[model samples]
Target chain A: DVKVTQSSRYLVKRTGEKVFLECVQDMDHENMFWYRQDPGLGLRLIYFSYDVKMKEKGDIPEGYSVSREKKERFSLILESASTNQTSMYLCASSSPPGQGSSYNEQFFGPGTRLTVL
Target chain B: LAKTTQPISMDSYEGQEVNITCSHNNIATNDYITWYQQFPSQGPRFIIQGYKTKVTNEVASLFIPADRKSSTLSLPRVSLSDTAVYYCLASSSGGYQKVTFGTGTKLQVIP
Candidate 1:
């Protein structure tokens, strides 16, 4: 089974504080993603990494950065956390497409609800 | 990336079958339709995926026609715990393809 685990289930930070959200996957998937879920707005992609040291910006990437130093780990960094950044953050990993009928099947962690005060 | 559109919300009774349709009129030839279910405070889980025709699993069935313009997710004998938001997105074939998830349909199961 593919297991994706997050570093925290909940977090609180003050404004302008630096925050880090860690994610790890056991299946050695090549693709990792970070997304933020907000009420009414739905889930918006923040960043994604296709391989080690390779990252791409998603729909909403402002004030956020990502690191993929190894295949099993992906980290999301908040440069200056603000109250508006409070939301549920999700981490997911997946194999490249065309692997089988499970093409692009993303395995997700439980998610971390971050609160910025 | 193909933009997907589905109903905002749906309601079903316990033990009844529920079908939610998602439209991807601009779906590309290499794009695959995937469905995900997410509960409150939890991350979205992959429910089912299909390229074309029909695909069925223990949890749900995905039906896609020849044109591949739309797809329907059929949840059989839904229970109270089946209530969640179902998201449908078209993912292209490749490792670097971008996936965009829309707001998705919120299913409410009533006993």
Candidate 2:
């Protein structure tokens, strides 16, 4: 079985403070993603890394960035945390997509609920 | 990536089968349908994936027709633990296309 773990389950930070949320996967998957889930708006992607040192912006990438220094670890950085940033953050990892196969199933971690005061 | 639409919520009883349907009228030829289940305060878990016809796994089954415009996820039996949000996503293999998740269907399994 694949295991994806996050650094924190709950976090609280004051406004204008910088925050870091970490995620790790044991499956050595090539793709890693970060998303923030809010009520009614659903899950919105923040950033994704397809390989080491390679990152791409998702739908909602403002005020957030990501790091993939190694294959097993992916980190999400919040430059200036605000009250609006309080939400559940989720991390997921998956193997590279095949040429013609529809096997891009992503395995997710338990998620971290971050609260900005 | 294709847009998917599903119900907001559903109700079911224990020992009863639950089926959730998702519609993707503009699904492309290479797009595939996948379902994920998310419990409260937890990440979404992969349930099943299928392109056409039917595909069954140990946990659930996916049924798709010839047109592939929609898909149905069938849960054999329901339990209290089965209550969660089910998200249906449409994705294709190729470039780096970000997967979009809709509001999803919330299933409340009552005893």
Candidate 3:
């Protein structure tokens, strides 16, 4: 079974404090993503990394940044946490889509709920 | 990425089959339909996927017609543990495609 693990299940941070959320996947997947889920808004992509040291901005990347130093690890960083940034953060990983494959399913980790106080 | 529409919520009884339908009128030829299940305080998990016609697995079945405008997910003999939010996604294969998730259908299984 594919397993994705996050560093924290719940986190509370003060305003203007730096917060780091870590994620790791054991399936040797090549693609990793970070998303935040909000009520009514659904899931919005924050950032994604297709390869180590390579990152791309998603739809909502304004207040967030990501790091992929190694293949198995991807981290989300909040330069300065704010109340608006508090939401459920999710990490997902999937292998590159193969030819003739119907879909490339993304396996997700247990989410990290971050609260900026 | 293709836009998807699903019902907001559904209710079912234990041991009954549940069917959820999703509409994607503009689905591209290369795009595939996928379904995901998510529990409270947890991340979403892939349930099934299909391009067209019918696809079945141990957990669920996906039915897509020729026009590909809509698809249905059939969950057999559901239980209380099956109560969760179901998301339907449409995406093209190849490379890294950014997927957009809309408000999914929440299924509540009752005794």
Lowest summed lDDT across 10 adjacent residues in model 1 chain B is found at B91-100
lDDT for each residue of candidate 3 in B2-53, tens digit (9 for 90 to 100): 8999999999999999999999998988889999999998999988999889
- Clashes by residue pair, model 3: none
TM-score of each: 0.97, 0.95, 0.96
**Which candidate number maximizes DockQ?**
3
lDDT string for model 2 (A1-117, tens) is: 789999999999999999999999998888899999999888899999999999999998999988999999999999999899999999998886773234678889999999999
lDDT of 2 by residue, B21-94 (tens): 99999998878899999999889988889889999989899999999999999998989999999999987765
Across A15-117, the per-residue lDDT of candidate 1 in tens digits comes to: 9999999999999789999999988878899999999999999999999999999999999999999999999999999988767457788889999999999
Q: Candidate 3: which docking quality band?
A: medium
Could you tell me how far off, in angstroms, the CA of residue A117 lies in candidate 1 after the best superposition?
Answer: 0.4
Predictions ranked by DockQ, top down? 3, 1, 2
Question: After superposing candidate 2, which stretches have Cα over 4 Å from the reference?
Answer: A99-102
Model 2 clash tally, residue pairs: 0
Report how far off residue A74 is in candidate 3 (Å).
1.0
Best by the TM-score measure: 1
Q: Write the per-residue lDDT of candidate 3 for residues A54-86, one digit (tens) a residue.
A: 999999999899999999999999999999999
